[model samples]
Target: MSEGKVANSNRAEQREQLSVAATATDGVQVLNPAGEIDHHTGDALRHALDVALTAHPRVVVDLGGVTFMDSSGINVLIAAHHALTQAGGWLRLAAPTDTVMRTLQIVGVDAVIDCHDTLRQALAD
Candidate 1:
């Protein structure tokens, strides 16, 4: 198999190991992540985001339940944002806890991904 295929297979396996859940409503997908989102959990978020993108043009990530996030998490969001934008869609961040919000702001991710104070607002937009 090609290197890219192998890597994708590995990613699929990894995504299966994580417990992220995604829901869709009115053409918008909402991804709810639990626990911490560091290097180990970032792939799960990526998979969830990828799945969301497949189902909807507008994706909203609900971060109200996330406790922590690292650079890996930020990278996943950035990549997802670019992918969605290129596909004529958009990614929205919703209800991020203070710490996660701060981390996103520190990395300047908030500027690239539209963030809202609540999921309702994100879904509405």
Candidate 2:
């Protein structure tokens, strides 16, 4: 299940440039979101994660394509992590861009969700 789609939030006048999509291969689910994941676009990410979780237990979110992320994005990830944890599953973030990685570190999100330098490394774990 590898597909892509652009989502528009309720911010009527302002169209969203953010895109959130997912792909599942070899028992690992990967979510790829581009552009900013702020209040307007966080819902898109949450929905994508929900779908991905339903299909795979071990989920790896590939953040290499993301340009920016705010607390809303972090909240989505945390929620996904909690859901997966409750289901005896897990979530990991892989290939985050420098900015995204720095944000995760500063917010202590990395402490909860493991961050890998590569998708392969995350899948291996």
Candidate 3:
């Protein structure tokens, strides 16, 4: 019974599918997150951003692979953007999908943070 419970727990953990790949190019930090971003997965994204911030101030978040997002993810991005700006850096967003772009638009994140159509554009700008 305990083994069955452990397996079920592992499966449940797997259901929270949000992964972040952090890297740096030139002087900017880039974070690529793939999967749904809800309350369950928001912390992972937040932690990744925080880690990236430690390396450099400017960050470009690649949202092309994100299929869905909720208020939690938005809040995280807002916090990261605020932190970056306060640190004399900025956060740019790259390649957000239609669903995620709609959410960002509704929240006016696009206005506050620069949103580019491509990663290359974001990196350049």
Best of the candidates, TM-score? 3
What C-alpha RMSD separates each model from the true structure? 8.8, 7.8, 3.4
Provide TM-scores for the models.
0.84, 0.84, 0.88
Local accuracy of candidate 3 as per-residue lDDT tens digits, 61-112: 9999898999999999999999999999999999999999999999999999
State the weakest 10-residue window (summed lDDT) of model 3: 10-19
Q: In model 2, which runs have C-alpha deviations exceeding 4 angstroms?
A: 1-15
- Please, what's the RMSD in Å of model 2? 7.8
Across residues 51-121, which tens digit of lDDT does each residue of candidate 1 receive? Answer: 88888978999999888888988999999999999999999999999999999999999998999999999
- Best-fitting candidate, scored by lDDT: 3
- Using alpha carbons, what is the TM-score of model 1? 0.84
State residue 64's C-alpha deviation in candidate 2, in Å.
0.4
User: How far in Å is the alpha carbon of 54 misplaced in model 3?
Assistant: 0.8
- Predict model 2's lDDT versus the native: 0.86
Ranking by lDDT: 3, 1, 2
- Error of model 2, residue 78, in angstroms: 0.5
Give per-residue CA lDDT, model 2, range 4-115, as digits (tens): 2222234432445678777787888888887788898888889888998888878899898888899999999999999999988999999999999999999999999999
